[model samples]
Target: MFTGIIQAVGRVAAIERRGGDARLHIAGLPLADGKLGESIAVSGVCLTAVAFTPDGFVADVSAETLACTTLGDWTVGQAVNLERALAVGDRLGGHIVSGHVDGAGEVLSRRPDGRSERFTLRAPPALARYIAAKGSITVDGVSLTVNTVSGAEFGVNIVPHTLAHTSLDGLRAGGRVNLEVDLLARYLERLLLRADGGGVNLDLLAENGFLKQ
Candidate 1:
């Protein structure tokens, strides 16, 4: 698991196609402590490091990942958000992120708001229901709070620090980004799925002391 906190901004060094799959060579991130087979969150996608390089590491990207994310469209020298997996006792600076890209979202607009930038993005129609105002969402591996939600579109404010540290500063209208909805929200929806015609509800919450009596 990851905390959706970007530790470094890495660049794509090379992409080698192997039939339908591809091997990505990333650079500009310290990988001395990383071992082969360890997971790394690259732009919201959990990829296993298969080999180490002097600066970064190499990971194989499957066809499914290529089709579901912007990685396929990545070009050499493109900056990407990078985050190592969360340690056992590390501080949870950001929300829990699985590094699993649920789907891609498109940048609808980006405008300045004081010292920050407000971004409005359109999530995939199937994933829009999982987004809520004030809820947490991960875009391209950076966890952000939802400032507003309207249908498939949502807004987020990126402070100057975040903009300077991560690759999100390079976003523009019509750009695509990997998106992972809140982990809890996804699980909550699963819990509400009833196999026997009854599942979690207000009455169940009250009975279980999750609601005011």
Candidate 2:
């Protein structure tokens, strides 16, 4: 789990392919307190730290993750957003982010809005239904609120501070990004489906001790 608050900006120092999977060595991300096998959110995808390097860390990217996110397009020296896993007592600065990329999205446009940058992105059609106006969405591991929605297209404003602290500043029109919808939104959709006679109703929930009978 993560809060979607980027802790550091890193770069893909090296990439090594192993069959269908790939191993990435990241540089410039602070990991003095991280341990081996720890979970880290690398551009909205959860990757396990397999080794520690003098500069950064190494993580293995599975084939499924590559198919679902923009990580496969990464190359050496590519800037990336990095966020450590949320600790038990840490403050939830951003919304709950599972680092599970539902699908990839494309940057449609970018325009200056005062000190901020307004970006419009098009989400995957299958995941568009989960996006809502004012709802939180994680883009490339950075949590942002949807300003408006039109079908699969949504707009978000990135403040100057965010741009300076994360890798979002490098994005341009036509760029692809990893996207994760809000966690609660996923559960709400499931409950609504069950309510609409999906057969997984409250009776089943009670039977499984998920709710009081």
Candidate 3:
């Protein structure tokens, strides 16, 4: 699990394709602090560290991950958001994020909003249903709140700090972003899918034992 809070900014040092899998070596990172077997969120995708060096680390990107995210668009010198996995005692800074990219979204517009940047995205049709006003959304691995949502489009507020700390600052209009919907919302919606037991109302909260335990 992750909180969408970016810990460091990393750069794409190299991308080596080996058959269907890709070995990515990311530099410009403080990997000295990263343990060899730790889980790291590389632009919102959870990947395990296979090796650690002085500058950064190496993680294998499978064909599925490359097909699912904007990581395929990456090249040398590109900046990316990097965050270590959440620990048991870590504070929930952003929201519960699974680092599972549900689908991809396209950047529709990006511009300055006073001191911050306001970005609008056109999410995939199926993924748009999970978006809500003021709800959480992860774009290119950065957790942001939806300011408004409508017709496959949603807006998010990006502070200057976000721009400086993460790769989101590099995004422009017409760019594509990796999107991951909320994990809890997925389970809740799936429960509703099984709700029509011949109009029988099952205590959803009760069945899941979700209430005060």
Candidate 4:
């Protein structure tokens, strides 16, 4: 598990394709404290550190992960967001992130919002229902709040500190990103489904005291 707080911006040192899977050698992140088989969040994907390198680590990307995320599109020298797995006592600076990309999204627009940048992205249709205004969403491993939601599209504001520390600074209108919806939203949907054959409704919210009586 992770907190979606990026620790470092690493680069794809090399990629070795073997059959349907690929092994990635990532550089520029300190791996001294990490050991072999440790879990690391590589741009919203939980990848195992199978081996350690002088400056970074190596991880194997499965075919399924490639097909589901932007990792498959990564080229040599591409910048990637990196975060070590959360320790037991670490502060939860960001919302809970499973490092499992739910689906990919495309940036529809990026406009300046004062010193910050406002990004509008379109999530996969199936994943859109889990997103909500003021809810947390992980984009390329960075946790952000949904400022607005319109159908499958949502908006987020990236502050200057976030831009300077993460790989999202290079984002453009057509760029694709890995997206993970809020974890609570997923479980809440399941609970609602189990409570009734139908999904969330006004009656359910009222019964649960989520709405005024």
Candidate with top TM-score is: 1
The TM-score measured for candidate 4 stands at: 0.93
lDDT-superior candidate, 1 or 2: 1
lDDT of 2 by residue, 162-203 (tens): 999999999999999999999999988776565557666677
TM-score of 2: 0.91
Candidate 3 least-lDDT 10 residues:
195-204
lDDT (0 to 1) per candidate: 0.94, 0.93, 0.86, 0.95
Q: Model 1, residue 135: displacement in angstroms? A: 0.8
The Cα RMSD of model 1 versus the native structure comes to 1.9
By summed lDDT, the worst window of 10 consecutive residues in model 1 runs over 192-201
Candidate 2 lDDT = 0.93
Q: Which residue pairs collide, candidate 1?
A: none
Please tell me which model should have the higher lDDT, number 2 or number 4.
Answer: 4
Give the C-alpha miss distance for residue 102 in model 2, angstroms. 0.5
Off by over 4 Å in 1: 197-213
Residue-level lDDT of model 4, residues 7-58, one tens digit each, is 9999999999999999999998977788888999999899999999889999
Model 3: lDDT to the true structure: 0.86
Model 1: how far is 186 from its true place, Å?
0.5
Q: Report model 3's TM-score to 2 decimal places.
A: 0.90
